[model samples]
Target: MANRVIIVGGGGGGAILANLLQPHGFDVTVIDKSTSHFFQPGNLWIAFKGVSPEKFLRPIPSLLKKGVNYVNDEVVSVDLNERRVTTRSGRSYEYDFVVLASGAELDYSAVPGHRELLERFGDFYSSPENSLKLWNTLRGLKEGSFVIGVADPIYKCPPGPHKGAFLASELLRSRGLAGKVKVVLAVPVPHAYPSKTVADILEPELKERGVEIHTFFTVNEVDNRENRLVSLEGEDIKFNVAVVVPPHRGPSYNISPAEVKDQSSYVKIDKYTSNVQGFDDAYAIGDCTNAPTSKSGVTAHLQAEVVAARLLGYDARYSGRTNCPIITDGKGTFVISDYDHPPIKVRLSRFKRLMEDLFVATYWSAVKYPEFWSPIFKAYFDATDEFIRRGEGW
Candidate 1:
């Protein structure tokens, strides 16, 4: 009998895992609450560059590979001892191996009155609808202080808030309103990015762009009436317009007898193997794992490959390597990170831009329309293997 592998989410990681395993004759089942799968990185472009959200969304049912069971329901509970999961629809599933890619939740209520503040502010980091809405808000703004604040330390995209600030600055400059606009970015971290190497490059670029950076400003509340962000230390920063990154947390059902979860409720997994602590037949990937890396789609993509290989009884392991291109006025700065090393900035060029664009299209096509992207992905996969072997050199 085939090994029954039950994946708890139909996200980027879970979907990729299903596609890889089903071809090897494993019984793969993916359960998710959403019927649509979205290209999340595209949300950044949609917010500032007016990219249509439709181009980034694909229905989940149309993307899954053949021979994989799809369950569209909410997970009720997971009994790790029994190796079983129950859904809100009264269905139960047994699994020989379990992969948790349930992803994270945006907690608007993490800060008091923050959800209400969404009515007046332009937020581009949460959802597609909000990103599109932010586009409209940007268009209507003439001249004022535009502030981008990080509400939490552990956000989905660590570089996203700075990206929004850069794009907005470019937009304001194009409109000849750069002198009239005050662009400020407030981050909870001491630096804009996680790495000092990337931060060194960004700090100078932000200064040249006339944008202000506020470090160590942990936003704890939103004063919508006054249009201000209040920090935990009782400090307040005023703004005419705001784009806030809300707090993130694990799913509500992240409870069990298993002691695999961390204090933040994320599954505690080995950084190199993606193995859930104390669970041999279980693994966690994506934003659900406390892997000491940015919780972005690229990280999830790499982790998916590692988890898939591990399940096939191979010796593959993840190395905490991923890259993100920070776009400013259609120009980009590529940031690459290797295991246990700080991210370094790579020089940008037309070739790098083309490579970035190709990856977005090829990756989505490989997962969403495999029949069309199979031949292309075969070659792309070869290149990716070479890149991985070379430690993701630019």
Candidate 2:
């Protein structure tokens, strides 16, 4: 019999793992709580502008193909000793190998009144509700200190909020509302973009967008009392609308303190194998683990490939490198990272920069759109879905 491999949390990693192993004749199952898959990388874009859900998400049922079974349910607990997973629906399933790519949760409530802050001001880093909230806020906002602030660092898509600023500025200009909107970006990081090289090139673009950059401004307290987001410096930026990007933390489930985890409760896995510390058959990948990579769809997809290979008894030759073209109004920078080195830098043409934005738009759309429906989405999704699909004749 082929090995029964169960992957939990059908993010980019799990979804890709399923496709990879199906052709290899192993049994694979993908389980996620949410009905739709989202291209998470696009959240930054969607907050400022609008993108169709159809272009991104694909339903699991059709996308799972013939051999694999798609369980559209939340994973509540995993019995690693028994090699079984219990979904929120109260059903338990077994597996020989388990890949944990459950992903992280947005810590919006880490800030008080954040739920209301999101409802009134909108937060771009959380869920669709927040995105839709941000969209509405962006539409009606005019002529006030419109602050895009980060609560903390370690966000999934680090370059995302800046993308929000870029697309939103273009949209506002297209609507002739550019002069009416006073935009300010408050970040804990020193540079507008993390890398100094990219920041230097894009600084002018930000200035052109009427975006005032504020560095070293950490959010101290959000006073819904007066509808103001206060900074650590006690300089209150009263806002017509506040777009908050809350903090991110690891998965909090089925975890024992005995097992290794990061300070943030993120799964601690070895760099190459992605195996949970002290456990051989159990593995975690993507944003769920502190896997020495930026938590994004690209990272998840890359780690998923390695996880699938390891499950199949191959070395899962993850050379530990991935390249992402970060889009910007200026000729954007290429941010490439590998295990051995820091994120590399390359400057691309203006046209190529535009292509990067388009590619990212298509890439992070799965939460609401499933993988099976759209051809463009399917092409990008199929490029990575590597897992064993449950099939006939064992």
Candidate 3:
């Protein structure tokens, strides 16, 4: 009998792991609450710009391969002793091994009257149903000061909030309100991003657009009455628009900080193996793992390769090396950045850009036109057919 495995969370890491492990004949089941798989890295870009959630979002069935089972369900808690996962619907699953890739949830309750603001103010960060909320709000606004800020320190992607601001700035400029519309950013970090070069580059980018930058400011609460966001120091900044990035926390409530989490409550795993401390059969990946790298698409894609190799008896060690091409509207250059603490930034050179373009071109092609005969790119190729061969839950 094959090893029975239950993988939790199917966004990036879980889906990739399921796709790879299925071909190897493992009895793999992927469980996630949501019906769709989101390209979250693209969500930041979708806020101001026009990118339908559907264009970026794909059905989970399209990604997994044969031998992998897909469950449109939620895992509420895990029993470490029994090595079983219990779902909110009261179903239980026992597994030989488990992978936790349940990505972070946006905590809107952290700020006062956040839900009201999210409904009224409209943020880029929203569910698939409210995808148009931010864009619709942006389109209606004729003139007003926009205040964008961080809700807390441990956000999913550190560069994304800045990305949203950068994209928003472009929107304001194109609308001819660049000078009249006041834009202020309140960042928790001392710098805009981890990279010195990118931060240096961003300073001019914001100043040129007449946007003000505030550093080391923590948004304590939102006073919707006066339309001001008050910081811990009691300083208030008014805004007509607010794009908030809430802090990220672990999905598993049962796993304690000492056992499975780091200081920030992110899953603690061996950076090389992605194996949780003291748990040999269990692995955590992507935003769920403490990889000490920027939580982005590139990080998840690379981590999938490492986790895949480990499952295949290859004993591959997860590399600390990583890169993400941060692009704005296909016109400006895509800036690349890496690391966990303070991101090490890189404006991707010609070689890197070519590689990224090739990767994107290949990735899109791989899904649409999978070359079963191709030797070089077959390993990375993925399609919906892979899961159909196994079984379709729907």
Candidate 4:
């Protein structure tokens, strides 16, 4: 009998794992709360650019491979002792191996007044509704003190707050409000970005655009009444327009399972292998694992490949690799790095735009075009990247 593999959370990692394992004859079953799958990376585009959120969304069922079981339900519990997973609908599934890819959740309660403040303020981190609302709010603002705040250190996308500030600056400048508007970023990190090499590049660009950077600003409370953020040290930063990234925490099922080690609500796993410690047949990938890496989709994609290889009887170890583009106004820099090496910065203004256009086209094609396969799309992406890298002569 083939291995019965159960993958929780049909997001990027779980969806990719299902596609990879199904071809290898594993009976893959993916469970997700939402029936629709949206390209998360495109959320930024929708918020900053004028792209519609509908363009990035597809039915989750359409993304899965043939013969793969799709379960649209909420997971109630994971009984590691019996290797069983129970859903809220009372459905139980026994699996030979399980992959916890059920990513993190935003903890609005971590910062007092965050939830209530969002109703009147603005944020475009995850929710589509919030992204659209933020865009509407941004378009109407002609002049004010725009502030982008990071509520915690372990939030998704370390560069998100920076991008928000940069994009806002561009928006203000384009509207001829450069002199009338002031932009400020309040973050917990000691630098604009975690990677000092990348921070050096971004800091100057921000300064050039007149965006203030307040490093080590740990926001403990949201002063909604005063339209300001109060730091842990009791410092206050006022804002006319506020956009914040809320704190993140892992799913509760893993902690309640009593099988996996919990590292501050995240599953404790071997950083290199993604194997859940103390478990022989269980693995945690993506944001759910307590890996000392930025919880970005790129990291999740790389970790999924490692998990997939290991399950197929190969010695695959997760390489702490990340490649993220800090794009602003159709152009920007690329921050690429691995665990063993420091991050390398590359600026390819035109190439970045070209890649962005090509990706959106290829992404939707992969969904609608039957012959435009993922493997083929990947080959095209890899070849185009190499071609551009060599063409730039960097």
Best by the TM-score measure: 1
lDDT of 3 at 385: 22
Question: Which stretches of model 4 miss by more than 4 angstroms?
Answer: 254-259, 364-394
lDDT of 1 at 159: 74
Tens-place lDDT per residue, model 2, 1-394, is 9888888877677777777778788888888887777666556556666755355555655555467767888787777777888887899898888888888887778877666778785666776666766777787766666777887877777677777677667767777888887777888778886666557656777897788888777676788888777877766667677777777788766664335667788888887888888789888888888877677766777677677778677886454554455565555545555566555445456865776666655453432233332356435334422211111100
The TM-scores, one per candidate, come to: 0.91, 0.85, 0.84, 0.90
Q: Which consecutive 10 residues in model 4 have the weakest lDDT in total?
A: 363-372
Separate clash counts for every candidate: 0, 30, 0, 0
- The 0-to-1 C-alpha lDDT of every candidate, in the order given, reads 0.80, 0.70, 0.68, 0.77
In the predicted model 4, the residue pairs found to clash are none
For each of the candidates, the C-alpha root-mean-square deviation to the true structure, in angstroms, is 2.8, 7.4, 7.8, 3.4
| Candidate 1: segments with Cα more than 4 A from true spot | 368-394
Candidate 3 least-lDDT 10 residues:
385-394
TM-score-wise, the better of 1 and 3 is 1
Regions of candidate 3 where Cα sits further than 4 Å from its true position: 256-258, 262-264, 329-345, 348-394
Provide the lDDT at 306 for model 4.
Answer: 81
C-alpha positional error of residue 171 in candidate 2 after TM-score superposition, expressed in Å = 2.1
Off by over 4 Å in 2: 232-235, 256-258, 317-322, 329-331, 357-394
lDDT of 1: 0.80
* Residue-pair clashes, model 1: 0
Against the true structure, candidate 4 has what lDDT? 0.77
Write one digit per residue (lDDT tens) for candidate 4, span 277-377: 87778888889878877787777776777888899999988667665667666576666655665666666486775766675577544433323364664
Task: Give the Cα-based TM-score of candidate 4 against the true structure.
Answer: 0.90
